[model samples]
Target: QVCPGVTPPTGAVKVTPGHSPQDLALARAHGLPLLSVIADDGTLRPPGGGWLQ
Candidate 1:
């Protein structure tokens, strides 16, 4: 993330929900690049690099 933008690529560690910003603010901050998807069961699925096959 912050590393790749400036230096060599690095792995990202998943942070806990308590550490993450609320869905709305996160979406607004990242805009189109980052998205939030909610499931019918109230599950949150962050954007994935998926396409129709």
Candidate 2:
């Protein structure tokens, strides 16, 4: 965990392992900053961060 104790960034999505790249791209194009791409083992990772304010 990079920042274990720190609060998670707002507007973050914990994506499942099966989420498609097309969905990811759409989210990004629509300004979805915080993308949580899941691994095969159900591990969640933050690829980027976005501001909702």
Candidate 3:
């Protein structure tokens, strides 16, 4: 379910636990994987284990 005050533009949400605190909470609550795709420098990091390949 979406967060209480959040309204997704597409009427759907993409969980990004590594980048968003709200998403992290949602991911943890749903036992979803936490993946990091961007580095601290704001660049796309190499895909790990073919996660985004």
Clashes of each: 0, 0, 0
Tens digits of per-residue lDDT for model 3, 1-53 = 55777655347767878778998899999998776767787666767524654
Model 3, residue 32: displacement in angstroms?
0.2
lDDT of 2 by residue, 1-53 (tens): 34455576455555433377776776677776553555566655445222321
TM-score of each: 0.21, 0.29, 0.45
Clashing pairs in 3: none
How does residue 6 of candidate 2 score in lDDT?
50
Q: Name model 2 segments beyond 4 Å from true.
A: 1-18, 37-53
Residue-level lDDT tens digits of model 1 in 1-53: 36546455456444333345775455556562443455566665544323411
- Which of the two, 1 or 2, has more TM-score? 2
Q: Alpha-carbon error at 31 in model 2, in Å? A: 0.9
Clashes of 3: 0
Q: By lDDT, is 2 or 3 better?
A: 3
Quote model 2's TM-score. Answer: 0.29
Best by TM-score: 3
